[model samples]
Target: MENKVNRNIPDEILASYDYQPFTSTDIEGMPVERVLPTFKATTGSNKLVDSLADLVNKTVRDGMTISFHHHFREGDYVFNKVMRIIIDNGYQNLTLAPSSLTNVMNDIVVEAIEKGVVTNITSSGMRGTLGDAVSHGALANPVIFRSHGNRARAIETGAIKIDVAFLGVPNADEMGNANGMDGDSAFGSLGYALMDAQYAQTVVLITDTLKPYPNTPASIKQTQVDYVVKVDAVGDPEKIGSGATRFTKDPKELKIAEMVNNVITHSPYFKDGFSFQTGTGGAALAVTRFLRQAMLDNQIKASFALGGITKPTVDLLEEGLIGRLMDVQDFDKGAAESMHKNRNQQEIDASWYADAANKGAMVDKLDVVILSALEIDTKFNVNVMSGSDGVIRGAIGGHQDAATAKLTIISAPLVRGRIATVVRDVTTVVTPGESIDVLVTEVGIAINPLRQDLLAALSNVPGVPVFTIDELQQMAEKKVGTPKPLEFTDRVVALIEYRDGTIMDVIREVKD
Candidate 1:
C-alpha cells in the first residue's frame, strides 16, 4: 500500500516515504524529537568490555538503531563483525545506520536483511548486491538516503536515534579516549564517528591497540564514550584508498581539470586567504594540482581546505600553499599519516563539517568547491545518487551541502561511453541548479544562468571554451543522440533528503 503527498516533485518520481516536500529555500531550523536513554552510575573505573557479545548484550535490544562509520572505506570490517554477532543472538527488526555503506559490507548486510535480523536502513548510500536488493523492494521500508550533512542533522535532531554506536578506532585507552590517527590500523580523521559518540545512548569503541589511560588529542573523548572493546583488527590500512583517490594520466580528465583551474584562477574568489574544497576523483584531484601551480605563480595562499581529505590536499598543507586542512574523513594512507605529524591538519566532526540545521557550518565559509557528477541537466541540476539507468548506484555524500559554496564547480566528462552527462532532465535531482555555478568538461565550461557574474568573469578566459548549459547539452546530444529514457516502476525504492531534511527527490524501482 503506497501513497503520495506532492510538493512539486516530478510525476516520473514517486514519494512513498511519508515525505513532505518544501521549497528549496525552506532551510529554517526545526525542533527535534529524541528517545533519550538513562546512564547507570559509574565509580570512575575503566569502561572496558570483554567482547562484542558482551557489549551487545548490555546495550542492544530488538527494534533499535545501530550505527557505524566508513572512515576505512572498503577496508572496513566492523560492520560485518558486529552484524554477525547481532544476527547470531537473534536481534530482530533492528535498524542499521552508518555514515555510508560500502561494497565490503554488502553480502553481510544482505544476510542481515534476509534473516529478519534487520528491517530498515539509513545511510549516505549503498552499492553492488546490497543496492540491487534494496532497489528490488527486498525490505519492509524504503531505504532513506541522505547527504553527509543531512545524516548529521538527522542524528542530532533525533529523527534517527542511535541506540548504540559501534565505532572502530586505531587506538583507544581503557577509559575510551580514541583517535583515528594512531597505532597500527590508523585510517585518519574520526570526523563522521564523532557525531555518533556525542549523541548515541551507548557508545562502544572497538580497537586493535589499547594505549595507557588518557590518550591525548582524542577525536572521541572518554566523556562521550560508554565502553571500549578490543578486536583483532578493525580494518586493512592498505585498502583505505585503494582506487578512489588516485593520480590520472588520462588526457581527457587532465583537460577538464585544466579548464576548472582556469575558471577558479579568474574567479573573484581566488585570492589570498580564500578557502576551497575538492573531492577525491581523477579530475577533482587533478584540479588541486593545477590550482597549486596557480597559487605559486600568483603568490596567493588559501585559508583552509575542507571535507573528505586526500593526500594531495595534505601535500598543499605541507608545502604552506594551503594554511590549514580540516579533515572530516581521510581518503588515503598519506592523509591518515599526515594527521599524526601535522598539527595544522585538524580533525572535525560531521555536524561541524556540514549539518545545515546547525548554527553554522564550514561549507558556509567555502569560497570554491570542485565536485564530480554522474549526470547533470540543462537546468544545472546534478545527480550523484544514481546511474543513467535509474538504479541506486551512487551516494549523495556532501553533494548538496558543499554546493552552497560561493563558486560551485562540477567536473565531469561531456559523455561517458554512450551516455550523455548533460541531459535535459536528470534521473535524480540531488543538488538543485540554483546552488551550482559552473560545469567543467573537456569540451567546454557551462555556467548556470543563475550565475551571471561567473558568466561575465569567465567570458573571455583563454584556452577554455565557454557555453550555455543548453549548448553543452546540445553538444553532448550530437555525439550520443538522445538516450532512451529509463523505465521505472511506481514503487518508490528510496527517499533522497536534502541537506536540510526535506524530500528533494525519491528513487523508484527500475523496470526490468
Candidate 2:
C-alpha cells in the first residue's frame, strides 16, 4: 500500500517490521525513551581475559546478537578475529550487528554466513562481496540497514538488543576503560560503539595498546564494560580510509563542486559564524577547497563543522577558519591525528551527532550540508542505499539526519556514464524530499519550492542558475536517454528506515 508519501511499500513487509509510513518532517523536541540493560553486579578486580576464543566463550552463545564498531573501517581486525573464534567454537544462528561492514570484512562475513554461524545481520551498510551475497539471498533473514542516528535509536529503544559487543579501541586499561584517540591504531571517536557499550549485555574491549588501570577521558567507561582482552594489533591505521574520502581532480566533479560553492555563497545562510557539514566524496572534498577561497574572499568564518571529520575540514580548523570540529568518525590519518593535538577538534558519539532522541544534535545547528546521492527524484527524495540495478551499494549513514540542515544541498553529476543522477522516482527513498532544501548538479541548481526564501535569495545571484527539479530530471533524461528500468523480484532484501524509525522504503531482490 502506498502511504501519504506515495511510496509503494508492500503490506506484508510493513506488517513484518510493524513500521509506519513517513508522513511529515515535523519532529521538533519529541521526547525519546531508552532501553537500559541489566548487568549482574561484580566487584571483581581485573576484567582481563586470555584470548579472543576465551572472550567469545565467556560472552557469546548460539542464537545471540553480537556487535562491533566500524571506526577502523577497512583496517579493522577485531571483527574477523572474533568471528573466526565463534565459527571455530561451533556457534550457530547468531546475528552479526556492526556500525557498518567494509570490503575487508567480506570474506569472513561470507564464510560465517555460509557456515550457519551468522543467521541474521544488521548494520548501517554492507559492501563488496558480502553485499552481492546478501542480494543473492545468502542468509535466511533479511538485512536491516539503518542510518547512524537510526541505528543509535534502535539500540536505545531496544528494537535490536545486543547480547555481546566486541569493541576495539586504540587504547584501553585493565578494567576496560577505553577511547579511540590514543595509542598506535587510533581511529578517533568511539561514537558508534558508545551505544553498544551502554546497552549490550556483555561488553568486551579488544585493544592493541593497553594502558594502566584507569584510562582517563574514557569514551567507553569501565562501568559499562565486562571484560578486557589484549591483542597484537587492532587494525592498520593507514587503511582506515580506503575507497572513501579521497581528493578528486575529475573535471566533472570539480564543475559540480564549483556550482555547490556558488549555491552556498549566494544563499542566505552563508555568513559569519555559520555551521555546516559535508559528506565524504571527491566532489564534497572539492567543494571544501572551493568554499575555502570563498570564505577567504568574503572574510566569513564558520562557527563549527560537524559529522565525519576529513583532512580538508581539519585543515580549515588548523587554519583558524572554522572555530570547532565536532568529529563522530575520522575519515583519514590526518583527521585522527588532529584529534590528538587540537583541543578545538572534539570527538562526539553517534547519539550526540544525530540521534533523534537526544536533547539536541549537532545536525540541528547546521546551516548548510552538502551530500552525495546514488539517485534523486523530482519530488526531491534521495536514495543513498541502492543503485540503479536495485543492489545495496551504499549506506544511509548520516544522510537523513543531516538533511535537517537549513540548506541541504545534494551535489552530483547529471549523468554517470548511462546512469542518471536525477530521475522521475528514486530506487529507494532514504531521505524524504520534505527535508531536502536544494539539489546541486553539474548543469544547474534546484531549490525546494517550500523554501521560497532560498529560491528568492539565489534567484538573481550571479553564476547560480536556479531551475525546477523537474527540469533537472528532464535534462538528465536527455543526456542518458531514459535508461531502461531496473528489474527486481518480490523478495525483500533490506528495509530502509527513516530517521524517526518509520519504514520509508524497502529493497527488493534484484532479478536474476
Candidate 3:
C-alpha cells in the first residue's frame, strides 16, 4: 500500500504534468458557443450519402481515428458494415476506437488489422477472438483500454481527437437529428455517442427511420452532424439486450443478490430520494429486483437511477418509483423505447456522467453504487481486469467511477467452485481499496475498516452475518485452497489509468 508518488512533491513539480484541474465550469446549463461557420454546408445540396462505401472513401483519410458506440450490443450490424466498407476501399493506418467491442466485431477487426487498414485501437473492452489475438501480440501496437468515464474525459480534453464518428441511430431527421428512443430498433440512451457528436470533426448519422427537419427531443442535435444516411435496418431490437441484461436463475447468484439487498437496506443511505447504480450482471440485476420490493415496503422513491440503462430501470421510472434515468448507454431495447416516450429519461454524454476532471459529474450525486468484482483481496482492492487463469477477461467499466459514491458495495461470492474470490492480493488493481466501502458475499458481509460508521449502523441487521474481511478471505481459502501464483514478465502490456489520468497500476503480459 505504498504511495505511488511522494505525497510531499512540490506543487510546482506537480503543475508541470498535464494534471487535469479538479475544478470545472457548469457547461451543461450554459449555451454552447456559436457554431463555427467554416465547415457549414449549404442548405440546397444533398448531405445524404448513397452508400457506406462511398461515405468511407470520401470522409476517411490516412492516420485518422474513427469511433463507434456499442449501444446495439451483440446484434449490432453497423460496425461490420462500416468496417467492411473501409477495408474494401484500401484505407490504411486508421485508428479504430469504440465504446466497446462485442463478439460480432472481432472477425472484421482482426482482418482489418492484418490488412493494415487498422493500425491502432482504443476501447472500453475486447472479447472472443479479437481479445485472444490482441493478447498474443497480433498487432504491432498495444491496445489502449479505458474506463467509460476516462474515455469521456479524454475526448473532451482533446487528448484523443476524433476525425470521424460513425453513429448508428434508430431514428433521425433528414438533417441528421438522431436519438435511440424511437423507431423499431430502440436501444435507449445515446450517452456515449453524445461525446462523439459534440467533439468529432465530422459526425455521420446512419439510421433506418428518417423524420422531418428539427426532430424534437433529439439526443444528438443536427447542428453537430455533417451527413445523414438511411439504411434498411440499423440493428435488431432483440439482440440489443442479449447476454448483458439477463435476470438470474441460479441459486448462487440469487443468494449473492439477497446479500447485496441486505447490505443496502441496512445502510444509512437507503432512505427516500436516494440515487444508485448497478451493473448488468445477473446478480447485479437481481439486486435491483430485491431493492424494488424493499422500496415498496419502505415506501421510498429514488431521485434518480444512473449508468447503463435496462428494461427494469425503465420500468421503475414508468411506475414513478424513480424520478429519472440518467443514462450513459443503453443495455436493452425497452430502455431505448422508453427514451422516446418518457421525458424523464435523460440522455447525457460521458463527461456529464462521470468524468472526474469535469466541473461536475452526475456520479457526484450518487448515494450508493452496487458493483461486481472478478476478484477482491483482503485489503479490499478489486481486480476486474484479469481472470482466475491470469487471462485478461474483464473490463474496467464503471468500477472506479462509481466507487466514488457515498456507499460503494462490491457484491461477489466468496468462491467460484475451486477458485477463491477473496485473496491475499488481486491480480490487478482496477479500483483502489480506499474507494471501496463494503464487500458483500453470500457467506458473509465485510465492511471496510475505514468505514466504521457503516459498521456501527449495520451491526444489528437481522438475517445478515457480518465478518471481518480477513475472516471472509480465510473462509474462501479453506473452501478452495490457495491458487498458484501468476507469473508475469517485465514488459508492460497495459497501463490502468485512473479517471483523472494518473497511472493506478500496470498489467504485465503472462509468461508463457
Give the candidate number with the greatest lDDT: 2
Runs with alpha carbons beyond 4 Å of true place in candidate 2: 29-31, 242-247
TM-scores, all candidates, are 0.95, 0.97, 0.90
Ranking by lDDT: 2, 1, 3
Could you tell me the lDDT of residue 90 within candidate 2? 89
Give one digit per residue, the lDDT tens place, for model 2 in 399-443.
999998889999988788889999999998889999888888877
Better of 1 and 3 by lDDT: 1
Clashing pairs in 3: 24-359, 187-336, 188-336
Better of 2 and 3 by TM-score: 2
Backbone collision tally, model 3: 3
- lDDT at 194, model 3: 87
Q: After superposition, how far is residue 172 of candidate 2 from its true place, in Å?
A: 1.0
Ranking by TM-score: 2, 1, 3
300 Cα displacement, candidate 1 (Å): 0.6
Per-candidate local distance difference test:
0.86, 0.87, 0.80
Local error of candidate 2 at 241, Å? 3.1
TM-score attained by model 3: 0.90
